[model samples]
Target: MSINPNQYKLSDRTARLTAQDLLPTTVSAGTETREFLQKVIDILLDYVKAVNDRNEKVLDFHHPEDMKRLLDLEVPDRGVTLQQLIEDCAVTLKYQVKTGHPHFFNQLSCGLDLISMAGEWLTATANTNMFTYEIAPVFILMENVVLTKMREIIGWNGGDSILAPGGSISNLYAFLAARHKMFPNFKEKGSSSLPSQLVMFTSDQSHYSVKSCASVCGLGTDNCVMVPSDDRGKMITKELERLIMERKKMGHIPFFVSATSGTTVLGAFDNLNEIADICQRHNCWMHVDAAWGGGLLLSRKYRYLRMAGVERADSVTWNPHKLMGALLQCSTIHFKEDGLLLSCNQMSAEYLFMTDKQYDIQYDTGDKVIQCGRHNDIFKLWLQWRSKGTEGFEQQQDRLMELAQYQVRRIKEQSDKFHLILEPECVNVSFWYIPKRLRGIPHDRQKEMELGKICPIIKGRMMQKGSLMVGYQPDDRRPNFFRSIISSAAVTEKDVDFMLDEIHRLGDDL
Candidate 1:
């Protein structure tokens, strides 16, 4: 039976206290607050149970206006009662899509690790900034330990690293650090002080953040040279060398090369060894954006997917949130050289980074980062790592890869009804759902165009059904194809089959 929060009338708890009791004073409201908190805890528990329940709908669909009316989302001058607040919380959960659901393959990130969630709650309770050890002593150390572990996994013995807001910020940090490495004086004199046009290289299949970093860092987006990729989406080493030579001939300074361990749409890994060799030849700083594929490092069986020449990279961006299933916004950027982070982005403030603190000032990491006050993103990941030992994480990663292979096999069995984009290099399985009408048709441009048009239409129907969630995107000229990723260990072979069956049921008519 549903616990109707409204049934708990005001006379039940708050009425026991007077107006003076409600007001902030020396008196403690522990009893009332504890009762309210217990109710809130019940709501959270219910939400968690629903997320794990396969019988529950992935999302309760509603149009914008309807959702607004259903939620009764309105800000009031006066605070709401605890009962109304609980009711609102329940309503909010009713509409939210359960990304933790086994069948959810909508994005690169989805999973609810209970241990990590507990850490997240504790982190919220602590509510400390990660800037200085003076404030966030435990979290600061946790960040250092986590980052060092990541660097060691990348084969770096000692280096500088910082956790940023996201992978995009991490990439930007690499871009800025590379720029500073090339022209040390640019920090004080600005980009105009540079001798030549600054240029960076990344594969055309690389994340758009690389190009965005170029534009944000004052290097024109045009200067962000995109090297061609092979059919598998790995950067072509020969083409990269040619681009470097052409840029050098044109008097442009090639300062950075970003090698993606996992491309977005296809989950392709660039040739890191080759990319590193070219970077060395061109005297450019090498960065590996392993945001999506970095978790593979934990797996002994699949670590080779991202291991080759990773140590050669001057910097690497890793996000534990993606494949490792840490909470959101857990991204780290590492540098080969010590103190480069401080040299590149530090803005020392005496108020924060005081020199005469009794404790060791080396822990005052805020000065070395772009953001002054950072969130405590390390604890959840740290706690998760502690809960799931190194070997346990490796098993988790291996299991995910196995699940991906299982999905591929299942898709291949229904070959006439599906078109495999390519053999997946990682956990991402890309394919198009060929409807009955299009299955027997000749593979041609017209057929591709028809498939593309039907993808979104079918997607709309799927959304209405709310049984499962998956993402679709066009890879270059190819039509919009479904990209299913396996990130959560919670997803089983049964869920994979359910997703496939749901897609077929939704798209077969088209």
Candidate 2:
């Protein structure tokens, strides 16, 4: 029984055997396994090419019931052949959204960096837990190096950091650290042991994760005070101070203040310098949630303008997966205090985090996080960084800004047909598409209300036509409007023009 996969045609081998024959310890399964993986890789490569092609649709949209009938999602009692599995992979890609598509402006996290994608494949192949250096030695060291460099970029001389699942978890970690640091006994004693009711503060325009963190941390949602934002969507420092004073007067302890570097809807950056000063005066832990805007820090031109005074923050949450265009699940939380995370999160699990390891136990970082089996998310980021040096990333940032400026310019060129919400300070270009019926109408409350109804109808047309995707949402101050994000490096001025043209084609009659 020759095990050489090439000896038999793929169709013949797949028809004869199932996945059980491809196990590592199975008799001479290496060649067959390699062949199977190669087939999957070939399918993935084709999908990647299709994603980059401008002619391809961003997605083949389907409702829940339709999707359930389209794909065979149920698990069967018997194992399927490798050939069926390969076909299944192809089928999955056929209906999935091409997030890396050139016209994908729906999310803050977009684009697929080839280097990072390769790194992700390698990490998946390694399949090792990031908890201990014993299993993921290279990745563990790479994480430290990447985190150290990130801290240096943030203008911190030295600090500790960890990659989290996403920006929300990163913010949660910051909240936990602040709470534990302020009241060391709170970790063991819970909220009952606290000296008083603990409260936190964030801008009304900030991510909803801040409020969620407060709820999860046992501080009621009402305890998370919402500071007022200015017309530009920035946190008003005076309002923040006033709220802190009000909370203090009520005998509640103000322990943490989260200043959003980039607000979600409007892309507004808070006044970091002013917020830092208020936090210092109020004796509050200053945390900056820079998950969406952190990539701008790579551009020296924008960093000083947008993220100035970030160094004064006690903690920061930055996600490379967003603006940096690394793969998803690459969020980092940095703390100015070196030992704060370990002191706050460590449970001293004797079995996993053994102190008697032959190697330096300090590298065993399992105990520093809430999860023991963390995914290896650092390799993709580190590899992407290596491929694109700091200057390359700066250029990428500058390009994105240039594209956003071009979009704003195009929007202004057709002012009669489009209404700009506000001039964007970041890559988020928000505006409204005015139908021919609404064109030349007075911009009043009634007109605004009528215009707000246009987005969802046009969005539905876009989906049904399989043209492009741009997200729409109603903010605190405004109704539904198109909020286009320019995160992918692949997006060009031509794509922007097409987006506007597509919207016109879809909504001009409405």
- Candidate 2 per-residue lDDT, tens place, 1-510, comes to 111222223657655678988866577888888888888887778878888998888888899999999788979999888877777777788888889998889999989888999999999999999889999899999999999999999999888999999999999999999999999888888877788899999999999999999888889899999999988899999999999999899999999999998888989999999999998898999999999999998999999999999999999999999999999879999999999999999999988988888999888888889988899999999999999988999999999999999999999999998999999989999999999998888898788788889899999989887889999998878889999999998999999999999999999999
Residue 377 error, candidate 1, Å:
0.3
Candidate 2 stretches with Cα past 4 Å from truth are 1-9
Best by lDDT: 2
Total clashing pairs for each candidate: 0, 0
Q: Each model's TM-score?
A: 0.96, 0.97
- The residue pairs in collision within model 2 are none
List pairs with backbone clashes in candidate 1.
none
Weakest ten-residue segment in model 1 by summed lDDT: 1-10
Per-residue alpha-carbon lDDT of model 1 for 1-510, expressed as tens digits? 223435444445663443344324425876666665666687778778878887777877778887777677788876666667667766677688888878788889888888889899999989999889989998988888989998998889899899999999999999998988888899999967988998999999999999999888788899999999988888899999999999999999999999999888899988889888888888999999999999988887777755688889999998999999998868989998998999988788878888899999989999888889898899999999999999989999889989999999999999988878899988899988899988888888888788888779877887888888889989875878889988986899999999899999998988
Worst 10 residues of 2 by lDDT: 1-10
Output the number of the TM-score-best candidate.
2
What's the distance in Å from true for residue 479, model 2? 0.9
